[model samples]
Target: MSKEYNVAILGATGAVGTRMIQQLEQSTIPVKSLKLLASSRSAGKQLQFKGQPITVEEATPDSFAGIDLVLSSAGGSVSKKLLPEAVKRGAVCVDNTSAFRMEPDVPLVVPEVNEAALKNHHGIVANPNCSTIQMVVALEPIRKAFGLKQVIVSTYQAASGAGQSALNELKQEAQDYLDGKDIQDDAEILPTKGDKKHYPLAFNLLPQIDVFEDNGYTHEEWKMIHETKKIMLGDMNAKYIKVTATCVRVPVPIAHGETVYFTVDDPSVTVDQLREALKGAPGVVLQDNPAHQVYPQPLNAVGKRDTFVGRLRADEENPGSFNMWVVADNLLKGAAWNTVENAECLVKDNLI
Candidate 1:
C-alpha cells in the first residue's frame, strides 16, 4: 500500500473552495488527513469530508503543518500572505488565484493542457482564470491538430463566477421583480466586489468584469489574454499567441460560454479536421452538427466536468478563419476539478 498524504483546503467556505471539498472526496489520492481552513469568521463552521464532519479553522502561516498538498482558492490577498508560508513548510500548493499565475517561476496549469508544468514547480503552481480554462482546453486540441495563429474570444459568463452572494442577489432580485415589487439593489458584489459601482445583474449584462485597465480591456479580459499565454506557452518563447478577449457577466447562475474566432497556421485545416480532433481529445466533448440543431449549452455544461464545444463553421469572409463555441462548468473543470487534478498528478508522480 502507498502512503497516505495530508491535504489542506484554504478558503473552505467559498463556492470554488466548497467544490474543492466535494472533488477531493472523489479523488483517487489517498488522504491521511484533511484540513479545512478559512478566515477567522468562518472558523467553527462544520464541513463534511468522506462522511465525517470537520470544523473550519482560520488559516495562518502555520496552517501547513504536515500538509503534503495544499489547494488554495482564497482570494488573492490571502494567497499572497499564506502561500509562501505553506511552501516554506514544505507543502506543495495549487493556487486558484491570479496572485502567482504570471510569476516567471510559477506554472499556470490546466491538467489537460499542461500537467507537466506541475513537475517543475518550486512548491507553488497556479490555475488559470475560469474563462480561460475552458477556452484553452477546447483550443489546445485544435492547436495541436492544426497549428493555431490567433484567437479572438467573447465570454458569456455566469454570475456564480462572481461568488455565492452575487448568485443570491440575482435570485432575490428576480423574485422581487416577479412579485411586482420594487427590486431593491444589493449590488454590493455583482460586477466585481472591489469595483467602485455595483450594477444590477438581473435583467442586465455587465460588460465590465474585474475593473478596467489602462489598455481599455478589463482585468478579467487581461487575465484571459495573459493567462492563456502563460498556460499554453509557459516560459517558452513564441512571437506571440495573439489573443484578445472581451469578458461579460450574464444573468446565468452556473457555467461559462465562449464564442471564439481563430485562424490556423495551416491553411488546409477545415471544420471536419477540427471536429475529428476534438472528438478524440481528452476533457473535450464535441456536440456539433448544425443539421440536427445540436450544440453545447451552459445548462448542459453545468454540473459536469468536460469542456463542451460545438457550432463549428468556417468564417465566410476570411478563408482560414474558423468559429467555435465552448462551454464548461466554470467552478468545476475550470476551478475545483482542475485543482484536484493537479494535486492528484502530484501524488501519481510521487511529487507530493
Candidate 2:
C-alpha cells in the first residue's frame, strides 16, 4: 500500500464514470497511473486528472494489463464480458452494475453499510443499486441502533440516474412543453432505455425504473428488496426482513430521494433518539427540522457526496413504526463515491 496503484475506469466517458475520476481526484487514495476506458467510439478523447491530460482508451479484454484496480460503471453486458478479464490479469474490480450484484460469490457492498463484506471478494465487488445505496446508507445506523424489523421505501429518482442522454431528453421535453409547442415523444431513451416502451419524462413520473419482472415489480424495485435483505442479514436467512419498494423517475437532474417507513424492534426509541443516531452517523447528513421545513432536496444535494436524511416522525396508527426521508447525489454517494470507497476499504484492510 505504500506505492500508488495503477487504476483503470471502464466507461470513462459516461456520467458515473466521469464522476469516478472526479472522486478519485478528490480522494486520498494515491494513484500512480490513471487509465480511462470507454467504447471504441469514445477512444482518444482527452480527460483531465489533477490538471494533467489523460486520453481515453477503448475497453477491450486486453485493457486490464498492468492494472491494479478496475472501477467500472459500464452496463451489465460490458461488465459481464470484461470484468473477469480484468480479474484474470490480477486486477480487483469494483463494478457499478447489476451484473454480479446478487451473485452468491460476489460481495455487494456499500462501504457505509457492509465494508466487512470486502473480505469475501473474489477479485470483484458489486456496488448496490443507486436507490438502494442511498436508502441503506441513511438507514444502516438506524438499523443498528433501533433494530429494523419491517421496512418500506418509495423513491423519487432523478433523470441523471438514467445517464447524459436522458438528462438532455428531459430538458428538451420540458422546454417544448413550456413553449406550448407540439411535443413529440421520442422513444429512444427513458424509464428503461433498453425496455420496449419509452415515455416523456418531462412533467411526469415514470413508475418503472428498469425492465419489469414477471412478478410485476420492475428490476429496480427488486434490487432494493434483495440488496437490502442481503446487506442486513450478513449471510442469514433474511426472509423475515419484510421489504417493498416503488421507484419513480422525476424531472430532477441529480440526487435521488426516498421516503422510508419502518418498524423497529424498540418501541421506546423516540423520534429524538432516531434523530440523534442519524445526526452522528458516517456517510449520512442529518437535516431534520420540521418547523423550518428543512429536509433533503435534490437541488441542494446535486453535487454533494453525502446522504441527507430528514422528516423523522412517528407513524400515526402503528406504534414503533416511523418514517424518514433520505437524499444523496445519485451519481456520487449512490455510484462513484461508493465504488471508490469500496476500493479504499480493500486497500485499508490490506484485503487486496
Cα RMSD (angstroms) for every candidate in the order listed:
1.3, 1.2
Error of 1 at 168 (Å): 0.9
Question: lDDT (CA) for every model shown?
Answer: 0.90, 0.90
Candidate 2 residues lying further than 4 Å off, grouped into runs, are 235-237
**Candidate 2 C-alpha error for residue 173, in Å:** 0.6
Residue pairs clashing, model 2: none
lDDT of 2: 0.90
Distance from true location, Cα of 236 in model 2, Å: 9.1
What is the per-residue lDDT of model 2 for residues 137-174, given as tens digits with 9 covering 90 to 100? 98899888988889899999999899989998899988
